[model samples]
Target: MPDAYSNIHLIVRWLHVIAGITWIGHLYFFNFVNVPLQGSLDDATKKAVNPQLMPRALWWFRWGAMITLLAGLTLFVLTYFYTPGAGFGATSLLMDADGITDRAMWILFGMLLGIIMWFNVWFVIWPIQKKLLTGKVPADQVPAARKKALLASRINTFLSGPMLFGMLAPAHYGTMSFGALLLALGLGVLAIWFSIKSSSRVGKPA
Candidate 1:
């Protein structure tokens, strides 16, 4: 059996993978299944379907994201920070003794994306969705709520790719310069901000 240290990170990695798969799977489900169904259904059908099925799915979706974030962050700390002296040459890989600055750049990028997603889920998407589901939000607000949720979800989908690349690259790249690390971080943050900011503009109801 692995020691406690190894066991802990292993568990976190496993949880991260599991939760990430759950989150992305449902994301695809919403994009592929729910959105198309929206067009085919009548207004009454939409009202019923959305208030019931959509919210349930979103609960799983957002929590899966949360769990993934927690587990992934924990793993990052344990593997990169807690371990001493560049185990397996992780420092050499990052061009640092601590190995964290390089990894930090990637984690920072991922955290930025996760922050946007969290805001969307908790602030924009959930609030608006509540209105739509509960009919508490003014009829005027329903459209706005829906638009925000859809747009934010799409934005998350767009950010997923580059964020993953940045997070995984240190492991694969052997070593990265401060300049290259900075460049990756800048590009990741810019991509996230642009995607989310652009999403808000396109969805306002006419």
Candidate 2:
């Protein structure tokens, strides 16, 4: 039988995964599907589609992000901070001779990326999107606002791959060698850079 803390952790972890999928799924939909489709549409069509479609999608996207972040943080705290007897305590790891294992390093990197993504969603993307959707953005400012949101969303999509690796690899594969871990990090960074560059050119004319 599982203890109370274990039960809570399990619940929170499940919520985290579910909410993450919702959030990231919508994100991919926006970047991969909606954006291209919007580019193909004329202004009249965009005006018709966006007011109806975007608000509904953005509602799911932002709320999914919020729920995922909350659940993930709860799980992280329950797993690392509260579970001293489990040998996974963050304090114990920090106090050990090695002082923060490679696994912890990967988790930290993933968490940092998650934090940045959350910030971008709430502070940057959501605000501009709200302005555009509500017709508050001036005509001259619309393109800039759209571009800003697009870039931030693209960045999140780019980071999602490596962030998943960082969060999951440690659990599945245990502590990787410093060199191997660095190689993985390098690959992740390169992939994100490539994605950002490619996404930037996606709807542009040849």
Candidate 3:
């Protein structure tokens, strides 16, 4: 039974990693490459290029996000709640059921961040992008709509690094301190900020 559960975990982890890569790859492409490219194009060029490009990319992006989320939740259930042959695993609490372990706290933090990112992708960014793609947004509201999506996407990006820390810290480092998780999150957001600033300088006079 343990072997079976292990196999399931391994397979789902693979799926989660693959889907996460696809989702985050598209996200970075849009942020670092497409945004600048869009600014350089005239309206006619945008009309010709955007329609042809956005839908295909977004299809994979959104679906990847969905798969990653589902896989991640499955893993959480398997790891923290039900353990084959071990009955109630983490929930068994070993010593304390009501107490939150450091590892659990970190994993929960990451899960929260990932869930929020998923919500933003599906509910906020996708809707706004759909409106833009379909020419459904009023001209006066287009910029605001675009801004809203961009902001949500940026927030996700900022959260990604810290989320990784939250997810990985427990597994690798074990018993991560709360302060350490907070520091990792802070650094993660700072890394995103630096990347954005540095990107603004590329392909320009040095």
Best by lDDT: 3
lDDT of 3 by residue, 21-41 (tens): 999888878887778778778
Report the Cα lDDT for candidate 3. 0.84
User: Could you tell me which residue pairs clash in candidate 2?
Assistant: none
Which 10 successive residues of model 1 have the least lDDT summed? Answer: 85-94
The residue-by-residue lDDT of candidate 2 on 1-206, one tens digit each, is 98877787788889998999999889878876677677679999888888999989999999999998999887767655665465554654323587776666767777888888889899999999999998899999888999999999988987887777777865775575777667666777687667545664675767
Q: Report, for all candidates in order, the number of backbone clashes.
A: 0, 0, 0
Ranking by TM-score: 3, 2, 1
What lDDT would each prediction earn against the true structure?
Answer: 0.68, 0.80, 0.84
| Model 3: residue 141 alpha-carbon error in angstroms | 1.1
For candidate 2, give the lDDT. Answer: 0.80
Over 4 Å off in model 2, which ranges? 84-95, 176-178, 186-206
Better of 2 and 3 by lDDT: 3
Lowest lDDT sum, 10 consecutive residues, model 3, at 89-98
Candidate 3 lDDT score at position 53: 98
> In terms of TM-score, which candidate is strongest?
3
